[model samples]
Target chain A: MKGNEAIAEAAINAGCLYYFGYPITPQTEISEYMAKRMPKVGGLCLQAESEIAAVNMLLGASASGTRAMTSSSSPGISLKSEGISYLVGSDLPAVVVNVQRGGPGLGGIQPSQADYYQATKAYGHGDMHLIVLAPSTVQEMATLTGEAFDLADIYRTPVIILADGAIGQMMEPVDFSERKPRELPEKTWATCGHRGARKHNIVNSLLMEPEELERSIRDRFERYRKIEENEVMCEKYMTDDADIVVVAFGIAARIAKTAAQIARSRGVKAGVLRPITLWPFPNKEISALADTAKAFLSVELSMGQMVTDVKLACECRRPVDFFGRTGGVIPAPADVAEKLCAMSRELSI
Target chain B: MVGSSKRIIIVAGHFGTGKTNVSVSLALASASRGSVIIDLDTVNPYFRAADSVPELRAAGVRTIIPEYSNTNVDIPTLPPEIASVFFSDETAIFDVGGDDGAAALGVYERDISRVGYEMLYVINMYRLLIADPEDAVAVMREIEGYSRLRFTGIVNNSNLGAETTRETVAASVSYAECVSKLTGLPVVFTSVIGDARAPEGVENVFVMDDHTKKLF
Candidate 1:
């Protein structure tokens, strides 16, 4: 399956019936796949007039306690930010997929990880954080998309599937049959009509009073704290006895994995630490590795957005380095391997 | 070995069905005969034959890509150099876009017909949407509707990427035969990765290297 199509199919398998999206390069396959499959599965796939309208439609679907999602690339994601903020303000559960392309404003159609800051730190306006899941392969694109919906419903917050154009466009073999059914909580707070049984449920984010708004924000953060403590997922490959650990996520991590293998073949103690959840940032795992590892290298498709988070995660206990290629240029594995070997030599370890 | 007698060979299929890989391999295999591969894929921005221009040129196969390919501009404008394929005697292979991408090929339907071209539809039974023979036939008809070109043969390119085995190729032979039977097109060849031989009953095996596999 192509990574974008895998996400769409996995969303359906995870009980996501409503998909609202606008077409954008690198991620357009998600909408295309949904348009073809949704009707057959007795669901709704609406291509809105714009990215903003698509996200607002997702907001409406999610408010009624329906499993819904919306996908776009970087510039389109920017247009959906306002709607995303509203979804968060209403404490809605929905999945937003950003098959990231290049940059600040309609940068390029090629793959990029420049939206790390946008996805993790400031997806929208307000005191809010999204559960960001970064998938490295086409298979994970399926599995993590299923997990993204579950995480959103569990926390009642928007979850971001932070993919890049490479994964989104690449084709691979994926098995969707192994998906286990999830135990999701009932949406008692949903604004779906009640049969004169209880009080009417209102779905609105407009809290007029400052104190009430602060309380609402604080309550959401408490849930975020629980997620942070329990949801920090990272994969440590060959890090058990390594001096230089490379930290990366999404497509960058897959490249780093190959680089680590090459560095190991050349007798360098290189390993990879892949963060699956970009928002939680995998701080504890990196800090744990800092106790033994000599240094850390953050490899990204961006100029170095995740480098800051890696540095802060390690608390400067070890030296952190950055290697990247911006503007949709993917770093080669050999180049990353060379960096790993050089870092090992510099540390004399 | 398939369509070697033809001057113009056009490869079309559903998305992710190994059309570009087949086109590249066919062009490289026929490089000694002097070939030019035209990347007429305007539908997809990534993983196009344009990405393999360096490799294709290195192997002595001339490559013609969209005017704005590999650039920030995502327009689907074909270059005027494409007309040279019709005039030259060199064997031209058009790696057309999958499904609706064939609409780009429709623009040159009259010229291609004038030159007498052979269109080969690539199929992968492992692809979810086109797993069934009926679904494969439906997509085949859709491509035909868009390009206004009749398929001369079928290329069973079914395999799980990076996980394909001899058994996998063998398992897909029945599916390919079903497609061939339904479309009244012969199964020209079966594509296998690396040096793996084609399944027992499959004829004219084409060994392909995944030139479209992105490093990152």
Candidate 2:
């Protein structure tokens, strides 16, 4: 399955009955797939006039106690950011997929991880953070999409499936049968009307009093603290007693993994630590590796956005390096392997 | 290998049906006789034949792609150089986009008809929506309608990537046969990845190297 279509199917399987999106390259297949499959499953797939409207529609659906989602590429994602902040402020549960393309603004339609800062630090405005899940393969694209919905409902916040254009366009064998049912909580806070048996449920993000808004924001941060403790997901490959640890995520990790294998074959002690959850940032794992690993390399598709987070996680215990190919250019395995070999020689490890 | 008699070959199918792989393989196989592969996939911004230009050039196959391909610009404009393939003696193979992407082919309908071309509808039984024979035929007609061209044959390029085995290829034979029967088109070939042999009853086996897998 193509990564974009896999996400749409997995979203549908996760009981997402409403899809509102606008078309953008690299990720348009998600909308096209939903348009074809949604009606057959008694779901609604609407093509909104713009990304802003689509995201607002998602907010409305989520507020009404429905599993809903919207997807876009980098530029379109920029257009949807305001509505995303609204979704978060209202404390609504929804899934937003950004099959990331290169961009500061309408940058390109090729695979890129440049949106790392946008997704994790400043998706919209104000003090906020989105639970970002990055999938390195098409299979993870499916599994993570289904998991995104559950996380949204459990945490009562918006979840972002942050994928690059490479995975969105690639084809691979995916097994959907392995997904086990998740125990999800009910939407008691939903404003789906009361039949005189209960008080009216209101959903709003606007709190007039300064203290009231501060309390609400702090309360949400408390939930975020719990998430940070329990939901940090990372995959370590051959990290035991390694001198150089390559920290990456999404498609960059896949390329880095192969490069690490090549380095290992050539007698360099290199391994990869892929953060499946980008928001939590896998700090504990990297911090622990800092004890034994002499140095770290952060590889990305952008100009070292995540490298800052990597440095912070390691606490300067080890020297950290950055390697990247920005503006829609993908580095070949040989190129990354060359970087790893050079780093090893410089450190004499 | 594609017969030398066919001067122009166009590969079209629904999305993710391995159309670009089939086109690349066919062009590489025919490269010894002076071949050119045109990347006419304007709809998809990623994983197009343009991505394989380095390997294709290494194999001595000339490639003509959209001007802004692999760049930040997402314009779908076709290059003027594409029209030259019609007058050239080199065997021209077109890797067209999937489904409505075939609409880009309509621009050269007259030139293609005048030069005479063989359009192959690539099919993968493992792909969703078009998994059934009837659904596959529907997509085939849709492509034909959009491109203003008709398919001369069917290329059974079915396989589950990475996990595909001899058994997996063998399982798709009956499905491909059903699609061939529905469309009344001959099964031109069955593409098998790497060193796999043709499934028991399948003929005209095309051994394809998985070029797209190296992209990641």
Candidate 3:
């Protein structure tokens, strides 16, 4: 099945009760799947008028303690940022999927990782970080979608599943039956009806006090720090005795894995570090590998967005080079292998 | 004999009915005859004829994509190279978009009718909007009205993805018959994924392993 459709099914299997979305390329299949199945499962799937309205609907649903989600591509996701920030401030747990396509504006409808900075650094105008889960495979797209919901509830923060168009549109064998329902914490603070024993729960993000807002923001940051320490997810391929490491995520990681294998076969000891969580950033793994690896190469579909993060993660101790294709162009495995071979030459020199 | 005699074969259907897959399959099937596939699809960029150019080219089938197909430009410009497909004697396959994509095909309506093209409306009975035969006929009429071409045949690609079985394909025979009856078209073939059993009483089944599909 297509990755977007698999994600929608997995979301339904994970007990998502509401799905509000606006149609956008690469991610429309998710909404289409949800529209067909959500009603059959006694859930609500509404295609909002726009991305802004979709995310706000997700906000309303999440505030009432319902598992809700919204999906869009790069341009649409930008429109939904205000609702995302509001959800973060209100501490509402919801899943927002960004099946990324190219862009600064209304860019082309092709797979791209150009939104890494926008997604990890500033999804909205705020001092906040979302739990960004990047999946490379269609199977991971389904499993991580389920995981996105669990993490969103556990951390009480908005979780973003950052998938590119390649992973969103590709067909692969996915077993939706293998999904296990995650145990969730009770939503005692939810704005469900107040049974007359407690004060009516106000699920608004409008705290007008300076000190109170500062304290609350600090408290949220503390949770973010804990999440960074405990919830960083990544995968390593042949990094143990390597002279070179290639850092990537999502579709680029899939290509980089092949490139690393090709480099290894060609007698260069290369490895791959795939960051599953982008906001938590997989810094410790890269830092530890930087000690042994002679250099690091960051491969992406964007013009060196994640490479900046790789540099910071390695603390500039190791030389970090970048190879990328921007504006909907995907980097080829052979091209990445060529870049890695050049990096090896530079290391020996 | 169905697609062999026809010089220009146009594949169209609702979105997600596997028209691109069928187009690629047809081009590769006729690769020895030097087939050329055009990416006439402008509806969605994710799943289209141009995305599989590398694989199609490797199979010895030439692919002509629209201008800025995979590039970072939203301009759905049809390059002048499209006229080459009409003039060439080699087999041509046009992987068109859904009902909305028919409007793009409207541009070539005069040439298509003059040369007499075959429009294969691929159908998956499990897909939405066209799950019922009456609804399927209605959609075909809508597509015909939009594209200004009548469907020559139907490809009943009734699949539920990985869960598709012999029974699934077998069960869609009546649905295919219903659609054929309403549209006054013949069932060209129903596509089966693997070496699974073909429909019990149906003929002309197209067996596709989908080898062009890859992980990366």
Candidate 4:
């Protein structure tokens, strides 16, 4: 299954019923794939008029305590901001996908990972926390999509699947399993139409009072703190004797894996630090590795967004070098290997 | 895949591939008049059908996308409006960015599943990694990691040039067959551009035009 199509099927298996979305580049297959299958499996699939409508539709469905999701790339996710804010403010469980691309705007069609900050900080307004999952391969797509929904329901917060075009466009072996649907805690506030047993519930982000909003913010952060404790994810490869280390996530991490292999072949004791979860970044893991590794290198699709975090993880124990390919250009494994080797030699590690 | 209440639809694949094009074709094909196309290709600057939002609007097909269609734009976290549209007569298409789509949209399934909906996974074997079943599975897992949604079906959108002959269709048919064997999700349809006839063995044929809304 393709990544997007796989997500649709995974959602269905995960017990999703209704799907709403608007089409855009890089992510059209998600809707296209759903259009064909949802009806057959007794599910509802609709293409909303706009991203706003799709996201708002998610709000409606989630407000009623249904598992719903919307997906898009960098720019499309931008349009979904207000809706996401409402989801966050209202504490609704939903999923958003960002198959990142290059540049600030309409940069290029090729895959680039420049949306790190957007997914983590600038997605929507106000102080809201989201669970972001970064996958390095198609297998992770299936497992993480399923996990994201489970976490969303358990935590009552939005979960994000952070991937790049290469991962979505790329293919690998995957198997779909019927996951045990999460037993969501009753949302006493969901707007299920105020019928017989249901009370009229409102889901919105319009907290006018500073104190009230502040309290909500504090609560949200408290939830975030628990999430950080419970859900920080990463993949560490051969760092025990590593003199030079590479920190990357998603597709970049995959490339780093290959780079580590090649770097070792060239006699450089290089390793990789792959973060599966972009949010609640696995700083603890990196900081622990800093104790053993000589230095760290950050590779990304951008100049240095996640690198800042990697540096923070090192905490000046060792210098953190940076390397990347921007403007929709993918970083080759060989390039990463070469860069790591050169960096190791330069640092005389 | 557990007992989830919401069914989700995810659109993901490589760039320069036809996930977007096929998404539009699939939405238009399965949709019965009043369907909407939600464009989420905020990653790519050009080549998004949202450029002509008025066209889909005039055609009675509504659209929802990111705040802007620029490259440097931020990817927003929005709601999946399934409840209102699910029971309504309108059909919807969510056009997500290729790889970017998998990450962001993967989280909302728990919410939508509670409402009752099925999800679809679309594939274009012509794209990288997805050309093989193993690669396809890998991509699937990555998407699963985020959306928390289970995929129920597959849509084959494979073609070479504008003149996608039977060969292109046949190759994809074989690919979809293998994927079906691996993932247990049937390929429901094969999409074509213009009046390109449906490939002989395909279940459904989705036709799209140049002016039709494209995601990537």
Candidate 5:
């Protein structure tokens, strides 16, 4: 299946019973898949009028304590930002799949990672970060999508599956053999018809009072801190005893992995650090690698969105060079390898 | 030389049916003497057949693409060189574009019908519009009407991309049978990714690799 369709199937397998989405390129297959399969599976799949409506529908479903999701490309995601913020503020658990395309606005529907900042640092208007998972392959698109639901429910927050157009459009073998345990905590705070025994579970974002909102912000940050401690996921290849490391995520990491292999064959000690979870950003792991590696190369499909995160992760302790192809252009493996070679030569490693 | 006698093979279908991948594989598979791949697709600029020009060129397959393909600019300018696919003696494969893209092949329609050609309609029963067998037949008919060429056969390339299993391939067999019955055309072969086993009694199968996948 296409990466987009695989995500929908994985969502179904993960017990996500509700899907509300609008049509957008690259990620349209996800909504299309849901529209076809959800009804047969006894689930509700709705093609909302707009991206905002779709995200708001997801928020409503989440408030009702149902596993729900919404997917869109870059521009459409931007339209859902207000709803996402409201959902997060109301402490709703939902999954938002952003099959990223080129953009600052209305950008072309080709693969791009420019939304890294939007996905990780600022998904909405507030001092909040989404639990962002970037899938490098179609299999991961399934696995991470399933995992995103579990993480969202566990953290009681919106989790974002930050996949680019390449991973969402490309095909590879995927097995949904691994399933997240469904023994999740009951939604005690869910607004789903609270009986006469208890007060109505008000799912609202308005804390009006300054002190109250401050305390709520602290509580949310505390949860984020706990998630940071427990849920930072990443993959490291040939990083041990390597002089140079490549920091990437999603499709960029796939190419970087190939570049690392080619560099190793040519006797360049290169490694790759692919951050599976983009929000936690694998700060400590890359920081630890900085102790041994002489230099780092941040390769991305955008103009160095994640490189800033990489530098911050490593605390600026090492020389970090940026290699990127923007406006939906994917960097070739050979080109990435050549850039790494040039970096190695510059550092005399 | 799978279809050696047929000079031109027009691979057409709805979008994302692995037509480009099939075209590339066909060119590579039938390149015993030499093969020419003409990229007549202008609908989707992202995953066009021309993107594999370097790979096909390396494998001794000549690819004739439009003037501005695989570039940031998506202009549907057809160069005169496209006629070479018809003129040359080399076995030619035409990766026809999807939906409205079939109209792009209308220029060569009269020539192609006159010279004789095999038009294969690739169908992925999993895709949105073509999920129903009736819808699949309708899509093929729509393309045939737009391209002014009749479909000689149906290529059951139903897949769920990477999540495709032997079951996924087999499930499409019944769908393909229905489509074949409706269209009065034979199911030429079922295209499976990698070595996923073909359905029972469907001996003719096309094993497709993920050559069109941009990354691993």
Candidate 6:
């Protein structure tokens, strides 16, 4: 199954109905697929005029207490920055998909992992963070689509499934999760209108009062802290005896896995640290590796988005080195392995 | 409008994707049970699928489109929030607007998951570069690329405008198969001009496709 199709199917199966979007390359299949499939299943699939409108629609659906989502490429998501901020401000539950392409502008259509900064460091206006999930395979696309909805509803914060165009359009065998009937948590905060057994509900992001807004921001940050405590996800490969830890995410991490594997074969003592959840950053796990792992080698599609976070987490216990391919150029496994070996030798010397 | 027991249907598509014709016919098909169409397209400027307003209403198919909507201005105001009402109330036929991809997404994408949304993309192989399997996949990718919302199914609405024929309907089936193969999306239904009335099991499209298929 193509990754985009898997995401669409997962959204529907996870009980997603309202879909709003604009057309851009590498991420259009999800909307195109929904436009046709929603009607039969009794769902709402609309193509909006801009990324702004689409994000607003997702906001509306979430406000009304429905499971909703939108998808876009780098530039488009940048257009949706305000909406993402608003969703975070309001603390609404929804899903967003980014089939990343090369950018800084309307860059080329080839695959690139450039949106790491925008996704992880609160891409929108003001202080906020969205739950960002980085998926590697078509199977993960399907798997994460469902997980995003669950996390969004549970935390009342937007969840993002960040993938590049290649992952989205690429065809691969994937297992579609059975569409289980969703039992949404009680919504005292939802606006389904006042009714029997359901009380009046208000869902808004306007915290105009200075103290009130500060309190709201504080509360939201606290929730993020709790999420980091409970939901930080990462994968480690052959780190037990390794002297250097390679940290990466999304497609970059996948390549790192191969590179680390190759370097290990040649006895360079390289291992991979892949963060499935880009946001929580898995600080504690990396700290544990600080003693054994002589240095941290952070690789990203962008020049230095994740590296800064890695350095912050590792706290200078060991020196951190960086190697990246920007504007969507993906470094091959051999290149990564070679870099890993070189960096390992440099740190040792 | 029917109840929780009644089947709920959504007839949605991008602008100029013939959603009006599709929704009306589907409502007519199930007229025996009470049905209604809720118009949710707030993006287009002049042409909307809204004019069929009275027909669906007159046929006992309730239409819930916002009054004064036109294809000319940017009226982002949607009819007062009635989604929860719709959920608690009756069986409905949701008539969504055509392709202002971004504009059409207003106020509806976030809550559908909790309230429940089975989203489908309206595909007109006639839309530029949308007919080819790879192109169709590309178009879907483009939408996903911009909005960050993935599509779940394909609506094969291939017609040569008003020149639509039975053969064209078959061609649409083939186009749908191509999409299913390339993108792993299924063609849930197909639309053709009203007069050509396709065979049983072939979901009929409400729009008049013969002339526009060539023009568009």
* Alpha-carbon lDDT, every model: 0.92, 0.91, 0.87, 0.73, 0.86, 0.72
TM-score of each: 0.98, 0.96, 0.83, 0.64, 0.82, 0.62
Q: Model 5 over residues B1-216: C-alpha lDDT tens digits?
A: 265478888899987888888888889888886898988887655678777888889999988898778664556778788787777788789998876589888889878977789888899887756888887877788897888888998888888765677888888888888999998998888887788556566768888666774553
lDDT of 6 at A160: 87
Compared with the true structure, what per-residue lDDT tens digits does model 6 show for residues A49-75?
A: 889999999999999888898999889
Better of 2 and 4 by DockQ: 2
Candidate 3, DockQ score (0 to 1): 0.33
Give the residue spans of candidate 6 off by over 4 A: A178-184, A195-199, B1-216
Docking class of 5: acceptable
Candidate 5 local distance difference test against the native: 0.86
Badly placed stretches (over 4 Å) of model 5 are A194-197, B4-8, B13-17, B25-44, B54-69, B72-117, B123-151, B156-184, B189-216
Clashes of 2: 0
RMSD to truth, every model: 1.4, 1.8, 4.4, 16.2, 4.6, 18.6
CAPRI rating of model 2: medium
- Model 5, A230: alpha-carbon shift in Å? 0.9
TM-score of chain B of each: 0.96, 0.96, 0.93, 0.78, 0.94, 0.73
Q: TM-score-based ranking, best first?
A: 1, 2, 3, 5, 4, 6
Q: Write the residue-wise lDDT of candidate 3 on A129-149 in tens digits.
A: 899999998889999999999
Write one digit per residue (lDDT tens) for candidate 2, span A313-344: 99998999999999888988778888999999
- DockQ for every model comes to 0.76, 0.74, 0.33, 0.05, 0.30, 0.02
Total backbone collisions for each predicted model:
0, 0, 0, 172, 4, 91
Calculate each model's fnat, 2 decimals: 0.76, 0.85, 0.41, 0.06, 0.29, 0.00
Weakest 10 consecutive residues of candidate 5 chain B by summed lDDT: B207-216
